[model samples]
Target: MGLFDGYNIASSGMGAQRTRINIVSANIANAKTTHTEAGGPYKKQNVVFEELLVNNTKNLNNNLQETNNKNTSAELRGVGVKSIVENDADPIMKYEPSHPDANEEGYVAYPNINPVVEMVDLIEAMRSYEANVATFNTHKNIDSKTLEILKA
Candidate 1:
């Protein structure tokens, strides 16, 4: 691993966590939404992450076999958000006869997003974001220290 690898990894984690926070916020905002252009209630959204691998040849002008054997370097570039997937699960139905969005059967549709779940996810996302920030700060400190030492 290289010195800058920490920054790359932390930034990736931050991006992923930021996406998660955005999705959770959207879900919470639309929790009570009973009407959407798509149809009934709003659907909950979640983020997907994928690992990133670094590939580079350490030795350039060598035989194929020798190069392959010599190049044993790998680095974690960062995480990427695959997609923001909507929950296909059915929405919770509430008996709200007087509600404006109520159906003919005297029931209103509500988003599948549960407040408890959204809150938990928000907390996790915030914590992950904080962790990434701390990691970035640590890397910055290390880089600063290395520079100071080099000047000595």
Candidate 2:
């Protein structure tokens, strides 16, 4: 691991969380949207995260193993967004005979999004981002103290 691996790990987590928050916000905003350019109700977007381990495949086992050996070259891992997917849950249907987008059955289709769930997701993402920021700040403080000790 490099000297700045801690910072990189925390930054990657923060970036992933930020993207999640943005996506959740958009889902909330479009929760009522019944139609879009895609010709359907707005589908909720979900962020899928993956662990990032930089280096050749040879180092994979070493990274996953517990290291009693301090000199081991096991790299510091980070979080990354693997993909953003649209939820396939069926659209909510409400009876509105006169609504422009109403079906032949006199029901209007609304986005499958639930504002409460989106808000909860938003809070979770914000908390994760805050945690990453705290981690980054701790690393910065440790680096600063190390420099001071060296100067002394």
Largest lDDT belongs to which candidate?
2
Per-residue error for 56 in candidate 2, Å, reads 7.0
TM-score of 2: 0.87
- Model 2 lDDT, full chain set: 0.85
Residue 8's lDDT in candidate 2: 85
For model 2, what is the error of residue 140's alpha carbon versus the real structure, in angstroms, after optimal superposition?
A: 0.2
Candidate 2 on 1-152: residue-level lDDT in tens?
57888988899899999999999999999989988998978889999987777433333345455444677755567788889999889999999999888999999999888799889999999999999999999999999999999999
Identify the candidate with maximal TM-score.
2
- TM-score quality measure for candidate 1: 0.84
Q: Can you give the lDDT of residue 125 in candidate 1?
A: 97
Q: What C-alpha lDDT does candidate 1 achieve relative to the native structure?
A: 0.83
